[model samples]
Each structure stands twice: as C-alpha cells, then as structure tokens.
Target: MNAEQALIAYVLRLADNALILGQRMIEVVAAGPELEEELANANFALDFIGQARMLYTCAGELEGQGRSEDDFAFMRDEREFQNLLLLEQPNGHFGDALVRQFLFESFYVHLLDGLTRCSAPGLAEIAARAIKEVKYHLRHHSQWLIRLGDGTELSHARVQASLDDAWQYTGEMFVADAVDTVVHESFAGPDLEAVAVLWRRDVAAVVEQATLALPGDQAMASGGKDGRHSEHFGFLLAEMQTMQRSFPGATW
Candidate 1:
C-alpha cells in the first residue's frame, strides 16, 4: 500500500483497538463491584471512546471519505474490526476485567509514548494527546492490579487466573504485522519489539508487587490485528450499533 493508505490503515487499527476495548468496558459500567470502581471504570471507558473518536476522525480524513467517526464506530460489522482478541475477551468477573485492562493499558501507554515521536505530524499530535489520557488509565488499572493481587487469597487467585487466561492474547500486541512494518519503517511508528521488552519488565514488576505469579509462555494467540476477532465481538457490536443500525442516521 502507498503511504497514505498505510497511514490510514495504521490509524484505524489504533482506533479500532480502543473503540472495541472501550465498548467491552462499557458492558460492565453498572456492574462494577464497588461504587468508586464503577465510577473509575466509566471514566476509563469514556477516555478510550474519546481517543477512538479522534483516531477515527483522522482516519476518515486520511481516507478522504465522507464517513465520520460515528459512521465507522456504529456502522461496522464484527468482521470489519481490527482489534486484538484480549480487548474483546469477556469480562468474566471484576478481577478479570481489571486484569484485562491492566495488561492492555500498560502496553498502550508505552506504545503511545513512542507514537508521540512519529514522523507523521498528525499521528504524533494524536499520540501526544492520547498519552496523557492513557497515563491515568495505566495508573488506575495498576492500582487495581495491586489491590486484587494483594487482597484476600480468593481475590488473588481469581485475578491470577484472569492474568493466566488472558496472557496468550498479549503476544499479538507486539507482533509487528504488515501495518506495523509500514508504519514503523515509513511513518516512524513505535517499535513493537522494543516495546515488548519494556512491557514485560513493567508487567512483571506489577505482577510481583501484586503477589501474583507471571504466566509462563506456552503458546500465543494471534490474528485480531488482521480483522480477526473473538466471537464476543458480535455481541458487542450488536449492542453498540443497535441504535444506529435501527434508526439509520438518526441522532439526538
């Protein structure tokens, strides 16, 4: 693909990841175990949704399409989304959701930090703005990770299992596929391999502090970046797109 096409694809991938994950988090908005945490989760969900809007708007402009951010967000089918499997994973329990966000936000903060230096001016600007939001997201989730990991034995075990079950999906985040190659080589995007090293160190430190064991590398799951998603994505899209799909351009 040419530079512009490559750039749009890259941006959409970032947007899709955030949007899909945000939608998943919204699923548990009223279901959080604690009142404070419920507010925190809602806050984080909105943050991701805002980031997605910015990225999607940029992507739409890059594509020179009439489509708006809402069009892309609320009109797409499950197969069209290019988010990682981890983001779409079910919120099994409070700890499960927390671990999922912890894993993603930790990696995402580092990635956004690197994106702030990208060769593309627009992308760099978006990254600069996004990094601020993601910083707090990391902080929120990290606190929870420590809380659950260092809490009662039952909480610790449940959260640990959440980490273990979700561990395989983490590999795909740093795998550097075609879009990654194009963006890194041409647009000076974040280096996934380098980010992976730092991600591991940061994640390991948090896991240790949480009194949780690190998951062993057995096999890694992949393919969310290539428009492949979990079965759960359909349900997410069904709920997210219901209003838009039913009304077709109707807005408040």
Candidate 2:
C-alpha cells in the first residue's frame, strides 16, 4: 500500500491495541483484589480508552471519511481490528493482567516516544500527548511486576508463569511489515527494530529486579497487524459492539 494508506492502517493498529486492552481492564472494574486497586484499574482503563478515542479520531481524519470514533470502534467486525494478539488475551488473574500490562506498556512507551518525532503532524501531536500517560502506565505496571515477582513464593511463581505465557506474544510487537516499513521509511515513523532493542533492555531490567528469568525466544504468534487475531477477539467484539449493533445510531 501507499504511504497514506499505510499511515492510516498504522493509526488503526494503535487505536485497536489501546481499545482492546482498555476493554480487557474494564472487565475487572468491580473485581479488583482491593478497593484502591479497583479504582486504579478503572482509572487505567479510562486512560487507555481515552487514548483510543484520540487515535480513532485521528485515523478517521486520515481516512478522509465521515466515520466517527464510535463508528470505528463499535461498528467494526472482529477480523477488521488490527490490535496485537497479546492485548486480546484473556485476563486470567491479577498477576496475569499485570504481566500483560507491563510487557505491553514497556514496548508502548518506547513506541510513543519515537512517534512524538514522526513527520506526520497529527501523529506527532497525539504521541506527544499520550506518551506522558504511557510513562506512568509503564511505571505502574513495572512496579507491580517487581512486587509480585519478588514477594511470596506463591506470588512469584504465578507471576513468573504469567510472564512465560505472555512472552511468545511479545515477539509480534517488533515484527515490522510493509505498513510499518512504509510509515517508518517514508513518513518518519518509529523504527520498530530500534524499539525492539529498547524493549529488550527495559524488560530485562524489570525481570532482573523481580528475580525472574526471561523466557527464551520461541516461535512467535503474529498476524494481528494484518487484521488477524486470536480466538478471544470475537468475544471481546461481541460485548463491545453489542449496543451499537442492536441500536444503530441510538445515542443519549
């Protein structure tokens, strides 16, 4: 695809990741381990959803379409979403959720920092605004990762298992395709190869502090960038889009 199309697709990929993860977090709104943690979970969910709104709005502008962010979010089919397979994974437990957040945010923080300098004016502006929130997200998740991993033997074991399960999904984050190459090469987008280097360093530091071992490189699960997703995505989309599908254009 051309540069413009590639950029549009790139923005949607960002939006989908934030949106899906936000939905996953919101699933634990009233089920957090504690009251304060529940509040934090809700707040983090809003942060991601807010990010998604901005991204979807920008994608709509880039597409030169009349579609609103709601339409892009609520009216899309499961296969149409470009979110990473990692984000769509089920939130199994408290530790599972934290591990997922830490891994994704570690990479996301670097990705946004690079986007802030991209040639696209809109993307740079959005990245500039979003990176501040992402910094906190990384810190929050990273701290929890260290806590759970270094805490009790039980906590350590569970979190470590969660990390291992999530490790395979992490590979897709740095696998650049035509969409990534066109955007980075022509549109001054983030070099994902470089992002991968930073990701490894950041993740390794946390793993070391937590007394956890990094999993070996294994066969990577991919295809979310190309609108392919795991089995969980359909269930997520069904719940997320039910209202819009049931009542087309119905609004408060």
Which prediction has the highest TM-score against the true structure? 2
Give residue 235's error in model 1 in angstroms. 0.8
Model 1 Cα lDDT, one tens digit per residue, 1-252: 777778888898899989988888888888878898889889989988999999999899888878899989998877778899999998888888888989998899899998999997588898899899889888888988999899999989899999999999998999987778889999888999999998999999999999999999879888888887777878888989999999999978
RMSD of each: 1.0, 0.7
- Clash pairs, candidate 2, are none
Give the winner by lDDT. 2
**What C-alpha lDDT values do all the predictions have?**
0.89, 0.93
Candidate 1 RMSD computed on C-alpha atoms after optimal superposition onto the true structure? 1.0
Error of 1 at 46 (Å): 0.4
Candidate 2 residue runs with Cα over 4 Å from true position: none
Taking all chains together, the TM-score of candidate 2 against the true structure is 0.98
